[model samples]
Target chain A: MSKFKKKTATSQEIPTSALPDIIFMLLFFFMVTTVLRETEIKVEQTLPKATQLRKLEKKSLVSHLYIGKPKQPEVYGTEPKIQANDVFINPDDVVLWVNQEKDKLFEDERDQITISLKVDVETKMGIISDVQQELREANARKILYASIKSVDRE
Target chain B: MARSKRGEAGVNSAPMADIAFLLLIFFLVTTTIATNKGLMLQLPPKPDPNQPPPDINKNKRNIFTVLVNSQDRLLVEEQPLNDVTELRSMVKDFVLNFGKPDADSRALYNSLPNSMKSQVLRDPNSSDHPGEAVVSFKTDRGTSYEMYTAVLDELQGAYYEIYGDRVGISADEFRDLDRKNPEDLAKYEEAREGIPMAISIAEPSKVGGE
Candidate 1:
């Protein structure tokens, strides 16, 4: 008779103590993998596209120089400007800036450090040549032109 | 009764998941996983003002000149080519002429496997061989970076495709050959021995824009 009697179902609650632990683990994973934005880009940029693009293998070994017209035309004017690190710089100052950046690296790693030219498509070659000349003067020979993979339309 | 009261006073962690979800959503919204990639080009050493440039006796037939004007027009070997996509196969044909055998041609293509040798198309007007072939790239000051890179891509793509075909591999695989691996390193070195990238970028013309 007792066995035949209906047994009340026990409400089983899921243990959520480990939920915070899992979340914390994910948080740490994200925090460790996130690359902080290197610099605030004041210039407008639309990277050119290409087929023979190679991924820059090491983030630590590359420094970018942004060249484009300023985003805020009212403030910075329509003329293309060069932004090295976090500051606006003249093309003449590239040598000094390259030297400064090179000095930050170890001697063995210095040669491997690439100076990536992030130039807008519309930017003229004059400034680009000036930057290239400055880079040559500074003995930073490796240059990577930033580009994306072109779709059929482009 | 006191124990019951203590159990009732336990910390509420119901909002913990919500908080974590908010943070997770924030990171998911703000962060990008893909890395930026590009074309790696090595600039020639700075020229010395005191030193005169060496004269090369390269025949006009051997030099494939590509000019990008301010209007983004592509001129290949002095002939205006309207479509950029045509540049790849055109360059490949120019670089791999199998019509007549020369000393340079023999030296360049002799090492390829027999299976690959049969694939070279015979063209008398194109380059004598890969070694003798030179692709000269130049651009006007007003030429957009897009056009410049597009031309460069086609040029390099030509070499990569040739190398890949000779080695019986894809271009991406050829590029991914790890130097750290002995077999891969050997294959890469062998592939590079024949179709060396010989694009010479001339100083951009100042005729376009100031």
Candidate 2:
């Protein structure tokens, strides 16, 4: 009969001594992996879609070149402009910009630096070719035509 | 008499977990994983301003011209192709045209899937081997970015498919091959040792917007 009685001799609550440690582990993970937004993205972007794509592994070795309509059409005009960092510069300025980017990196990493062209889907290839021409002039030939993943095969 | 003999109770740590959870939830909500991936391409080196452009005479069979007009229409090998998906098979067939099947050529033929093996449509007038084949992708200024990427995707996919077949893995696995892993790096180098992807992007036709 005594065996059938309620067993409240010890605390029924789960031992939560490791709860803080577990939470802290997850907290550190989030802290370490977080990459805060650096660029303001002055231009309006709608990335094109593609199926076969390679992930850009090293963030330090990439120069982002944005080609899209200005977010405020009235101020910057409707024409799709080229944005490198903060300013929307002319196509010819790409040489200076690319060279500056190359200069910022270490000597060994300079040659391997890739230019990522994040262009709008609606954008015409005319301005894009202009940027490409400037890229050639800059001798920064390695390019990654940035795109989102697509469902369709094409 | 100077000191009280009463025992002190333990401080509560229940609120500490709650605080950590709040911060975790904030980061989870605010932080976005950067999804930066794309089709890689390499442009030709800048031509010397002082010297004349060297006009190397390439065999007509070796050059595969794909023209994308301002209207987003595709002209593949001078033939109008409506579907971009068809480019994959066309490119594979063109790349693997090993004329005069020897030991090396026979081995290449075996790498292709059983489905593709059934179609004996090798062009004698086209490229002799993967080494000589060049796919020249030409676009018009007015061509939309979507169409250009769509076409480029199909072209690159063909090469990746071939590489995956040679290494006995799927195309997705081939793309995800990390150099950090020795086995993966070996597989990658083995698959693409001689058959380099030589898709050249020619100058675009100046037609549209600034």
Candidate 3:
């Protein structure tokens, strides 16, 4: 009975030598799968809703342009603005940005690249048209208007 | 003999879990799964201001016009339409009009294949045919993006429904058809045989506040 009791006591304590290995495996999984946010969003954009929303297939073939009011309304006021990458840019500068972005991609992939316009629904069409004009000037014909799926469509 | 004594102790692995935990926390804080997706639309070529506008002398009956004002009100063929959901059914009806044989065009309802013949109705006032049908969308400058996209969705939905019906499949299934597959590509082609996507977005009018 004493021997069996001793055996039970020894088996009760669990082995933790493989704990770090398991944690490391999970760490690697998250490290590979997670895509870190590239830019700090300054503009407050609430995307419009639609039923015909399509998912963007490739990430590398797309660039995002944010248009809306600034998050910090006190400093930037309530007027809508345009945000490209890390800086706030004027509408005319969109062409230059597109050219620069196109140059970053390979020659074959440049034509396939799509520009995603993330705009607030309440924003006026004046700035949107200006951006579209600039995009045309830059020869970026494919435009994706970022929108969420409407909840009631289901 | 003294050098052999240094092998008595092994490197400690107790801190490995702490290091891994720290990394996991960092990644959890810094990483964000990308949820960005949207409605894709191709823009037309830049307009030449010096050039004169092209003449549109076609039958007004063939052109299904939709006007969205600043107040987000929709006007279909000069009639005020309140509900956005009703827009798709209206567009579908106009596109698949199956009109009578006029002096210039044949009867569109009788020209369909054996498959699509039963699904469509013959209406002399609807349209000459799907091929001749055109959807013209005009939005005011003050129209919200939400209203614009909702209207656009209904327009596309109308075409999708017609295409799905012709192909004998659900509209969602038709929309999700894999173009990369040869069979799906053939179905898509057959579905869009006479009906082309003829949505024309006109230049915004200055009716609302800029």
Q: What is the TM-score of each predicted model, taking all chains together?
A: 0.88, 0.86, 0.83
Top candidate (DockQ): 2
Counting clashing residue pairs in each candidate, in order, gives 0, 0, 0
Model 2, span B30-125: residue lDDT tens: 677776799889888988989999996888887888999999999999999999889998888888776445576567667756754665356778
Report the C-alpha displacement of residue A141, candidate 3, in angstroms. 1.9
Q: If you assessed candidate 2 against the hidden native complex, which CAPRI class would it receive?
A: medium
Fraction of native Cα contacts reproduced by each candidate: 0.61, 0.84, 0.68
Model 3: runs farther than 4 Å from truth? A1-22, B1-15, B100-119, B181-183
User: Per-residue lDDT of A1-154 in model 1, one digit per residue for the tens?
Assistant: 8989876796578888789778877877777777778689889788888878777767777889999999999998998999988889998999899888888898899977799989888887667877887888888988899987777732
The C-alpha stretches of model 1 lying farther than 4 A from their native spots are A1-25, A151-154, B1-10, B98-107, B113-116
Clashing pairs in 3: none
Q: What's the i-RMS for candidate 1 in angstroms?
A: 2.1
lDDT of 3 by residue, A1-154 (tens): 7665654445765788898999999899889979877798899878888777667766788999999889999998887889999889998899999989999999998977799999998887667877887888888988888988788873
The collision pairs in model 2 are none
Q: Give me the displacement of residue B174 in model 2, in angstroms.
A: 1.9
DockQ of 2: 0.68
- What's the CA error at residue B194 for candidate 1, in Å? 3.0
Give the Å error, residue A125, model 1. 2.8
Each prediction's whole-model lDDT (CA): 0.81, 0.86, 0.81
For model 3, give the TM-score of chain B.
0.79
Q: What is the TM-score of chain A alone in each candidate?
A: 0.79, 0.84, 0.79
